[model samples]
Target chain A: MSASYSTHSQEKTQSSVFRTSVCKEALVMDDELVLRQAFASDPRKGCELLFRRYYTNLCNHAIRFVYSKEVAEDIVAELFANFWYSRVFDDISTSYRAYLYRAVRNRAYNYLAWQFKRTDSMDAIEDMPVDPTLKPDEVLQYSELHQKIEHAIQQLPAQCQRAFLLKRIEGKKYTEIAEEMQIGTKAVEALVSRALTRLRAELKNDWFLGLSGLVILSIL
Target chain B: MTPLPKDILFDFFDGKATPLQRKLIEDWLMIPANEELYYQYLDEWETRHMQFFPPLDEALTQYRQELNGERTRRVRALYDPPESPFRFQRWFWWSIAASIILLATGGGLIYQDQWRYSTYRTGFSETATHRLPDGSTVTLNANSVLQVPRFGFGEGRRLVRLTGEAVFKVAHLPDHQRFVVDMGRGVQIEVLGTEFVAYARNRGQHVFLHKGSIKLDLPQGKQLYMKPGNLFTVDADGHGKLTETAPAQSYLAWQDHWFYFDNTSLSEVVQQIDEVFGVQVVISESGLARRRIAGNFKATKADQLLQSLSELLNVKITRTNDHIELRTLTL
Candidate 1:
């Protein structure tokens, strides 16, 4: 599904460039200039334009790390709200898009850390083994984390891997996955739970410790 | 080194960049402007390969409501006086009528006593700073009243009656005169020269010493000496406890329009908003009222605080007239 979407996106990008037939960098610069001018003249209009321009992109970018649609949207919405209320645009030297993306990335990292701490405390209560040295913000490398997650998913048992992928990636319900696998819903839940535990164990030794745990927890 | 082309950066984003190209891009990202460019490109890439498109119209509508609420609050703050004019006028007429009746009934002593002491008051959502006759400064929090005797205020002893919260900075005199703040319920704070916060409300009485030392005279004839960071609190039933490790600065944050809460429950927070800002908040769900939050929030107006609370808790807060309701978002 993602492969076909990416192909279609490539075609759309090429067509957009051909239709404009101008330097994309110049267009981006012009947009920034206009946005700055709007902010200088009337901040409300600037806020509207800014929100419209980056809300979707910021949420999409944030979902890469947080792995939850609601959380990603919240992260972006909070960024926009704070930007407007705090008047951050007045002193911002960087483009609004850049500042927003960077801010959202940092917020997403912080959210992950908070989640890890909450689950870590719960794990302590349950006497589960937890890695203490793992710090998401310190060790977060986007591409590397993605590769590590993919690698860990591949190492799961075949049925467990299928159940996990169908649940986490495709966002299918337990009942749907059970029907697809010709199993009961309870069996599907057990398979997914086992997959999460094994993935956490598999990724713990590689310094991607609490983050992968949080990623799987977010699915739940 | 020459800047990496846009295609190479895109390839890096797509996890297809060579090791050397990735290394070069990482180095280039060290520059701040280059970092901005990096995000701009990332924004473009995500736009082209969009995974999810949020409901922009709904978000815009929410944003507009927040903005409108803030603007109306600012406008109201600028134009609205602390108390309604008609209420003040009605109170003035009733006092005049009562004073005439007292004179007619030959009850002049009580009226004379009212004239002997001057009172300082802060209306709802308002704080006031006043310099007393003794050159000491007192900053009264919202909805507080302090009474100082007009005649011979700082002669042999200094004493004042307080209701609600205030911070006092007592000026030292060469004559070694002591200042006493008489909070009702037999709780009095005595100090030679010190800075402390006294909170006397329907709930209880509390005194936090910021500098110097003070003596708290509690009920049952018990007395406690408070150091710079000591917090003496008495409940409504006059049960007193002293905390030595209280964060003194957070207690003073309210003077600067900031509220500091440490794992405070939502119900208690709502009660504080009622006291400090005079805003009525109703949490729809009983379970939600027990949720605890810890943070420092800055809000000069009621709506700003409400907005921050809603955002922090991911709750939906709606205001109708003077009443505010909080509920969990049903998404």
Candidate 2:
């Protein structure tokens, strides 16, 4: 098991990290240099640095899925401990941070999916994350934008619009869209392009980017 | 001659094309239906939720502490063997070794973790490719950030929170993956397996399906399955109206860095340039803003875009610092 951090820090490690600026920087860096040095070399400094590196980002990321600080913090601890004890990160080839992030995302999603089924009920937009920091105006804006977007989608041309939605919204491939639509790839591109053109015209090609940047955020 | 690979769709978007390669895509764009790709991307970019989401500061802080402590403990154990005396000198050596590691790893700063934070007051631009536990791939446009938890995904269903617009290309899983993209306005898109482009922004949002299928659960609780070539429209109330025959290519053109203003007015063009370049572009004479324009320009900096407009409109575009001033240039 390349998973290290094997030390027994599993004890309620408590959230007393100094919240040093260094950890913040490390958190910001891709998990490349850190993970590569996991076993091949010493990264930043030691296990503490690893904690400092990923602690907050992991916690924030995990909270979106888990809804419990205790669980979130524990996940961070385990991830760091594994990186240190086994240097499993050393085995990773892609962005170390990406790997860890992917891991966390998967864990969180699994928990959410399980929780969803246990409730025996599914609500569209269920448990909408109402961040306290989000002002009422922003919340309103998100809803307004959602409605506007729906109308915009309705305006797209028939074949082109269908192809665009199938590819972009459903997460399918062109071949899939083509096969489903029983048309060529060229047809799919047309659907997406035409749909977007109508939307651009509707918005008058105005401040959509600004609106989206603010409202569209990490749901993880 | 070898045919261009499938990447032309993306290569054109990123500006990595060679001259010959560019010529092909450009020529392809001229085709009536082909132009749809650009229009679609433009609409997609316009409405994506690319703006900032509230920073989760406090939660991030606590997680850091926990991870940091675990790391520190491991290092302590590695340096101070069980038999080694708990002497001051041994402890001091461990501290020094630890400090050395700290310096080598960049103090963990995520240098350029992403492109510049947000595009200037105009807006920041970013494109992200996400690999879901379900093995599917999703891409987010600039200014749009989709959040996913650290935990892994499970069977059948996959869920995600999307505050912004994104293009999804789902990789098929052994089990049919149930994919959901949640855009906050009570807009939830649920699909089994397919590909599509979703553009969501303030004032309006739209979706163009290129392949497979999708089920949209509107804010008002209406369930709509948008079939191939079937366009779906919904208002804030989730009341959906459908249409057929939408040319979908335009839905993705923005990815090409190509902005097409077909018979677009001057005011609208300038407004668009301002947002894209993150700089203020003011038409010196207010009347000129209403003038109509017909042509295509690079989806690039404000200056380049303005230059193209000036040339075609037979006008002069002057720049003072980042402020763009446009006026009719006597032919």
Candidate 3:
């Protein structure tokens, strides 16, 4: 681990427990050294700094899962609040970015569970693991893949992107999604179909799902 | 497996399908092509992230800028025992602004400076000075935040978003670019080649032009021009009314520790005090919300203003742990 890496692991909080970090400066600050010292002394300060660093990115990431800004912002805030109060953050022993990204994933799943409470479509998504091997290479690869998908989706018109994101990523029931988005269920179906057709036209046979894609998405 | 009706497919996906419908969709799931497309959709979706971030943030940011001109000058005017609140305000907004500016101006061609700006905020009873990208000057008061986006007229719109209140002496740019200040209450003030003082919050937008011409655009799509010596108040409803002002110099009298209120409501007066002096002033009764206050007091401290108010209105002022109360004083 680099000298600058800090995270919310449960091991460090045996003393302080989970308290929100007070440090909320930017991540790309020129005075990184000053901030690191500050974070080491005050983990809540570290959380604040981390929040400042990732607020926008996490919001953007949540939009990948939910359609409502209110819901997305709430989900992001909930993740931060949990991260702050959770003993794990008090013990940050790794890169703050990785710890937070994983935390967001957990929070997102929880949010998804609440979002899909009445529906049976998203029953397959189990609890997320710590994934001890969320290596830099994998993170980099996924980041790049995310950028590529963003670019591809950006190429499509706005409505198609909305439908595709809602149906696929959110795993939302059509009626619920239609109600949230203020569109008819038939329109939602047509949109999903249209988005799939457009995506298929674009991908051709490029193998969007590498084995896990097929199995997981099939069940999802 | 054969094609199922859209309703049957919907019910199956929603898990509300009857046993037959469930069995049929499950059987259809056995097909490789059909299943492949489903995951492919997820994979592609997980990519673009149309799921998390939405367009509303950008829209709101735009609207926030258009309402209150992007800087709030808060005045948390207390000079007693120093506390953490003062230090927190001084550090948080300044540090955040400095950090974001670094990220924004860093050597990235992908940066849309328009989407980026510095947000400056001050806390109660505190004041600080800041410089803008355009060499303009600003003095932030307590509990105020001003956002200066990444892109000015250099690339596109020269707009700044405001949350609380601030005093601005906008530097003139020769390119004839209009520097616009956006407030939160559905008002925007466009000015150029002159200096002005502005105050705005979530629901109120007020402007006192120092020397140049400013075009005020209300959230309700009404625009008014405030010439020199003009003061305008744009309410929450985006209705703006112009009033004659003594002079631009009078607006700066508060810097000398004095404020003059001419028939302003008790609520409005209390809000100004809370923002400027950083004290929570509460009206004991709801009727005080509508009580019209007209008075002038010393320009030195908050206690002086309180004394003047108590004497004139015969209003008893009580201090509690959380806030000060103003009530009808017993004669």
Q: What's each prediction's clash count?
A: 0, 145, 57
Candidate 1's residue-wise lDDT over A93-166, tens digit each? 44677567667766665554443332312222221111222232332265455455557777888998898777
CA-only RMSD, every prediction: 24.8, 27.7, 21.7
Q: Write the per-residue lDDT of candidate 2 for residues A135-187, one digit (tens) a residue.
A: 32332233233345556666676776677566544435556677898987666
> Relative to the unseen true structure, what is the C-alpha lDDT of residue A137 in candidate 3, on a scale of 0 to 100?
29
Global CA lDDT computed for model 1: 0.68
Give me the candidate number with maximum DockQ.
1
TM-score of each: 0.43, 0.39, 0.39
The window of 10 residues in a row where model 1 chain B has the poorest summed lDDT is B78-87
| Residue-level lDDT tens digits of model 3 in B1-331 | 3544555644432335576655565565454233322222323333443334435455334323322324221111111011110012223355465566645665332122222344676766566678765667777655777766421112222567676667787887655556778776667888776777787765667888878789888766878888888899768665677887755544665644556777778888887787777788999687766777755565345667888887777788899998998998665
Q: Which ranking of candidates, highest DockQ first?
A: 1, 3, 2
State the fraction of real interface contacts model 1 keeps: 0.31
Candidate 1 scores a chain A TM-score of 0.61
Model 3 chain A lowest lDDT segment of ten = A211-220
Distance from true position, residue B304, model 2, in Å?
2.7
User: By the DockQ metric, which is better: model 1 or model 3?
Assistant: 1
Give me the candidate number with maximum lDDT: 1
The residue ranges of model 3 lying beyond 4 angstroms of the native Cα positions read: A1-220, B1-115, B151-157, B244-250, B265-267, B285-295, B298-301, B311-315, B328-331
How well does model 2 score by local distance difference test?
0.49
For candidate 1, give the lDDT of residue A82.
70
